[model samples]
Target: MSAQSTATERRRIAISALARELDGSNPASSAARLSEMLDTPRQMIVSADIDGLVSAAMLASVAPSWNVVGLVASSSKWLLHPSVSNEPPAGLVAVDLFSLNHDSISNHVVKYGAKRPMLLNLRAEWQAWDAAVAVAAQKRLFAVPSIWAGTQGCYDDAAKADSSKWKYPLGTAQILLALLEAADRPPKFFDRHYLPWLVANCDGGVSTYTKYAANARVWWAVMAGAVGPASLTEQVFRLVDGMRPHDFLDTVNALDRERQASGLDPWLNDDWNLANSQATTIERCLRWLADLTGWRDPLLGGIDSFAGWVEKPVKASGAVYIGGANVTTKSTEAAAVASLQGARSALNANFYHGGFSGSRFNWIGGW
Candidate 1:
């Protein structure tokens, strides 16, 4: 289905009605009803990984007029990102970027206080942080879904605690899905986009799937037309399990298989940043995956590996480096670099429940 970049006055009225039905008090409930199909067209920036590609693709599938403009590593990375511009990028949207503000997110430690989680037109309201910060907010942005009640014991309260009872870095795609589904824009042919929902809905896909499900249900899920090969996500996980799952290396094999099975181009080969980033993206992806899964395994009654102290060697590469700072590696230290872009107070990102970047195509900003 082709989605035009238009929403009727009645449509906008309808969209608004559902979200603030009550104040934006609860994120999951609020996000489920969130829709930013405003009259304004958006230029979106997303992460450079396979998930970002999928998030962009799914969003395009629904919000056709919104442009999938650029890519970055995490949401805060975009604040000082060269892409942060002075004008024309009127409606900036960020998708699939990790937004949790804490680094070294160990046990249920509230290293920071929490932001009152609420819903907003993430598509319409997002903005860059014009300042340096060790950790950007929005992690645990959504309260845990009740389905995974087991986590309630640790998550005790989302409104006041910044530390997570448990953390899983996947599932932005799923949270996006829940948004569309709630907005009366229910998706179709999404079963083929198996990775989003499966990695999100399934128990092991994320931690405390129930309590965490409440967290934007992700950074967020959208059902593309099909779950072409839901198993592919897991297979891709295992394929890159021991290695860095960067630049869609995990997906390359899966997409290649799909290409051989069907003649489609797998959609990712043409990604704006994929070609240049493949060099270093994989190694970084694998290492992060390894670190996360390593600690997660022991928590889930699996074998202990390195007791979580095995730090991977660090190197500077665009995949992890953002604006001269390492955002992912030594995550806690990857603060937003002070901007040379003058004293423009960054806009308050209206849509950041959990969300939205790629390449230096001279692609400094996302206009």
Candidate 2:
């Protein structure tokens, strides 16, 4: 077989192997399997994008012994958020990351309240410091990195390096000084100082890290746009529009294998971020594959067919705004019926029961 054919065969076999690992039967075993895949602590913390976030919640659910704290937008508004509902599906606690004042966070850290705190997005610098201080105060609280910071290669060096062992003491010191001189530390400092150390220490250097981060940005944008502002979402889709199909598929396939092994569902679910992320990725991969083979997605047609194929579905797939809901059924037909009934039940129960709802339904054959 040719090189291309051999690669394709390898990917197919890999995907099948991964699907078994992701069978969703035992989450603890799946998490253990996932832990083996990460070479660095940063990967554990930074890589939890959409599917990663879902897998974290799953592992927390199955392993109740490990305390999982979810950092949300607010301490006061969290109860109002749908996350207060049963969607996390287990003993995961959602807390306002900002709730603990400086004193409270310090006190909480000393107590080591949460075992592993999961920060899905670190939009600003202070958030990173907040996570670091919380985790550093207690070694048991795993130091998790941000999706952008971890995957981007900026934080990987510090994350992977043993602070006790100093290879380039001078360089490290300079970076530290730069970090302290907030104004002098340009955004590029991360790209310049830390990326070199990461490349020198890790397997893949800046180029490899760049490719991964770019792909992750695309996946994140899709999930974020599902509940976030449209303008921000549109900008992210445009960011990776020019990425080669082969490269994009390679990343998706790699992630799919890992996600499945982690016991993340591949189907699209309205409530599950991991499932929705997988579904959207699958759609994007299929669209790219079609274009590479000179086949147009009949659903999308335009002058720049490839661009049309890429942009339309990404925007449309996540456009249907819906709140989080936990759903399970034996098949797609059952899912459809259950979802419809659940919506109606929720509405009626809310109207009659004063904004509170409960559901217990039976399917055909008592499934």
Candidate 3:
């Protein structure tokens, strides 16, 4: 099917509009503006991660006309992705792309030279609120800040973005869920299965899960009629609490059912499960390590332990490394150094950044 553009489409809603809409006491912004953008027919480019996958699926379930064109984690992939790079359709929109200090506008969107791209980005929800605004201001894009809580949507300038206004740690998926509630279309199931993997991928473990789990519950509550504009934190834990995964597709079988029921389009024309989806840093690093150093270790308690073991090689030519779940960029760097210095076993070191995964290394580079 060919892409079509609407002649009379309005630009993206203002941050002030979202700020008011999300505010509980003064619910000034009508759902029309936000809903208009949501209901716009388009092909979507989604982040190749849990939150992005969940956001797109939920969107398709609600806006039956939209299509998903690609699942990419990096900006270069966003441009060269086979589904979009060669003959991209019109009305292309990118949703929830991870910002590992990536300037997508300068990188690809500006040079796209097709129809303007619509973006729903919340990377500023990390800390650099002004950075997000900068991306939205480019001439070649139709941008709206998708942030909900911290930074109160955005800061007008860079100087004010000093620190975060976060009351609790949360993900962009929850923010989208809240906005969906405002749009009066709520997804059926806020997944629960692969929620742990995000934390594991972050090396934050269950504690990271504990910190942000309530954000999912907040979305569920909005669906249940709590309100729009998700709050920052939960002062106390209710019995019901939260552990929902914004991600869908628990299994290959379950994905089939979800698509049939939700009428969701294919993910970059492919189907996958929790194990080896979203060819991001975690998977890329794993493959690179295997090729570079040939790690054959099993889960040795955790990755920190693995890192520790790799750091101190006792006159051994080949150090046995462990792998489980953890990351500290410094530790990873040190271990990479150890791999060369102590063992001289590996030919080279492969570096990776863990920012996009919502890990402790948010926006920071590492080995």
Candidate 4:
């Protein structure tokens, strides 16, 4: 295949593996779940193209029983495999596709003699949110997606009835506030795009999954001493310094090996619990080691600053902020301009005082 095709396949494999890891489900188990739910022989349908093969492989990673059938481009139909010709597959699962199109998707049930077809919308939901806002703002923009929780749903019903009402650990806001406050100028996307998105998302009216995860990652990152680029650079060094601790180094190496073995992207894209735990443990261990070695935070008492920032609601101009810059759109609902843009301007003023340089550090996507 072509180089681009190979790279795309690799990325697809990594994302499927990452999804399994995040949901704590293996292919056999996920297939078993589907089998129990649908009681059908799972077969994944795809076009005979290279991208279709990648999708088939990703689906097979999640649904082990899934047999792949490539629909021929010339005929617009699949050549029925001999093995299951008589009985036929029960259900066809479509992967890496969102919209309903193509004969492989549109005619799968009739063509394949399947009961129903399932679409594994594995693409991150924040993509939808960003697209929505981009359309609203009339701009061509891409958003950095989140890895803070399970990617299945828009919101965890058990966690909170309304997404807007969710509460975060204290001092979470302080980290972001600190980053914005520390910047030499307004962040590139702050005034024009990001600020507006943040205000609209955090208002709690919509079930924007990545918004919460983004907030959590930032909170944990700050707690782990990554307030901004300066500290982020330092945090990397500290993580490397962790090599001296045999236990921690071994665990890190083990995780690295696991990802390599599973053909997953060696990045923090799975399990927010693990990410949070590792950050918390690493910070504590590093702090203890620093005390012994006469190392101290040059920025000073970041944890304290975090605590101070989230202690009370912050106000500037007409906007009020709480729980890590999440604003309540409830009070501002009546006045659209005053509520959205006003809050956006206020946030811009708060976070964009100093100038910023370079791109935002998207943990998963990278800068």
Candidate 5:
């Protein structure tokens, strides 16, 4: 099928799943359901383009009705705007902070307390944080907590005690969100400092790591576009060539040995043993460096080639005549080619085929 057709089919599948979820159907009904629903795996769907769906008027929320036994009603229109290409989506709600400021609940109970009102308020803030997360998820936006705000259990010990005493980090989610909202257009580029800061601070899981890495690349590409290729070349070189080749190779070999001793396939257990994300990223940086410098570096080229081999299958099929030299023999190469093609087709049918290099070609070597 053509790329456009494939994308259209994917969009249809995604929207249909959203519709079913709105209809109060569970997403775990079957394998097809899992494939269609964005939220099934939770992790993968969390960072999907939820804003696009909302803009398309495809999302709705079900709220409990006033009558206890009555069915829930759909209320609250959900809409989202992508502030930055790299930042998570934010929700907008117009509340009268002025009214709350003079209210009995805010003045008597919240502001001035005879007992530990701060703790109570903090608890309420925590609840609000949870609600915000839910809203963000419903909109299919990234739900990143403030680094210093203590949401999702990410905060310093002292800051967690009192909401009023919340401390802010430089690269906190709030800052990023604000930047995203302030920008007139999607932020495709970011400073080098921001990239490392994000990587070092981001929480790790497959989705979190993937998003962070993707954003970093986006920033790199943007910077390269603005300043010219020379600066990007330096940055890419620093990232890839800074590491010692011996150290990386030794680490991979050691891991392989350990996996062999444990009777486990290193490729399955530890992706780095194969052409994993780390290896792929490193190779990509090297290739970008080569392109920038216009010089063929052996180390970078070698690693790039090795990574490709690891990512792609090595297929060798040729017939050998078993009859004596005096007798003529015929071998069928067409059968071998057909068999290989069939296997390739089967692999393409599976999700996430062709390994990291194939899927992430831009990052790997093609630039």
Candidate 6:
């Protein structure tokens, strides 16, 4: 078949699947939830060539609202932008980061750059936030402050008492400090706690799943080469796994049967359950498939590393020699020296800042 014909067929299938999902029994559930209800075999339903489908616009953004939820709730927002732009625009383009990848961000900076390009990051960990800030700083890009709530102790009342307060855990505080250091200019930094206030007072609508998925698609597309195919698949699988419930699959199948039997195209069908499920399912499937197939990762890359960094040594120093004689130095020595140095630095830094000396090392110093 010709490429055009194949594209048409694929879209028909997508439309059929979506129609089935919308015709399900529930009116309140989203597509991700409906798919769980239908017991749609994940492997069977999930397009094997997801990246290609996304690129060709066979699957597109269904809602902007849900995308927003996924972005704000997750720990890593790095991939959010591309996910947004998976579908081609129907009308005038809006302000969004989904179509831009790291390289694209660079190109934009080189081309038509804004004073502060909005950066929507979902990293909940302090270190990840810091790393993102560091990159932003290196590029001299302005950050549109976003809520990253996934970090440990991130939601503490004291940590969130003031928007500017540094009372958060070391990792969280470090990220803020990094942002300040990088921008060489302080842009507004808001934690998750401060987000409700910011959004309530701001003029724009909140981010939604549809918007997030669209942007996420864009993000994945832009970073396709960087993330590779395997890694992308794993990420997509994780995304689907995270969003899908057990009942969604069964619900979708039942709904689809109903729609076809009624001679209704799901998107245009009057059935409330079918419409709702179809919309929800399409959105969830598109988002998951985009992430899984667009980016690739080698399997050998340690899955445990997804948890974040550890101080594992790359190589042992073989042996140490003292006075021309080999002397065995305990492996714990390195750890001890690091701890002692860290403590000393904390004390000295705290004294210089006129804060309580013990506060800096509270978790480590046993104070």
Question: Who wins the TM-score comparison?
Answer: 3
Q: What is the C-alpha RMSD of each candidate to the true structure, in Å?
A: 17.5, 23.6, 18.3, 25.2, 27.9, 24.2
For model 6, residues 1-367, the per-residue Cα lDDT tens digits are: 2323333333333233223322224342122232232222110001112121222121112211111101111111111122222322221111111111111100001111111212212111223423443453343222112212111122211223211111111111112212222222222222222222221111111122123342223222222222234432223323332443432333345545755796754531221111232223334433333343332211111122222312121111111111112211354335423432343211011101113221111101100
Candidate 6 at 359: error in angstroms?
22
What residue runs in model 5 are displaced by over 4 Å at the alpha carbon?
A: 1-118, 141-251, 254-367
Query: Cα lDDT of all candidates, in order?
Result: 0.31, 0.24, 0.33, 0.26, 0.23, 0.23
The candidate scoring highest on lDDT is 3
Model 3 over residues 125-148: C-alpha lDDT tens digits?
222333433453342232222222
The lowest-lDDT stretch of 10 consecutive residues in candidate 6 is 103-112
Number of clashing pairs, model 2?
1
lDDT per residue, candidate 1, 19-55, as tens digits? Answer: 3321224444434324434224655555555555444
Query: Over all chains combined, what TM-score does candidate 3 have?
Result: 0.40
Ranking by TM-score: 3, 1, 2, 4, 5, 6
Candidate 1 local accuracy as lDDT?
0.31
Model 6 bad stretches (over 4 Å): 1-132, 137-144, 147-153, 162-280, 283-367
TM, every model: 0.38, 0.21, 0.40, 0.20, 0.18, 0.18
| lDDT of each residue in 1-367, candidate 2, tens digit only | 2323333333333233223322223332221233332222211110112222222222232232322222111111111112223322321221111111111100011111111213222122223433543453242222111111122111212223211110111111121111112112111222322222321212121233255442223223332232234332232233334445454445446545755686744532222122323324434433332333232222212222322221111100000011123222223334433332333211011001011221222111000
lDDT (Cα, 0-100) at 216 in candidate 2: 29
Candidate 3 Cα deviation (angstroms), residue 38: 3.1
Off by over 4 Å in 3: 1-19, 23-32, 73-83, 87-90, 98-162, 165-168, 190-274, 277-367
- Model 2 RMSD in Å is 23.6
Q: Which stretches of candidate 1 lie over 4 Å from their true place?
A: 1-29, 36-39, 73-88, 98-111, 114-162, 167-169, 190-256, 259-276, 279-367
Candidate 2 regions exceeding 4 Å error are: 1-49, 61-136, 145-367
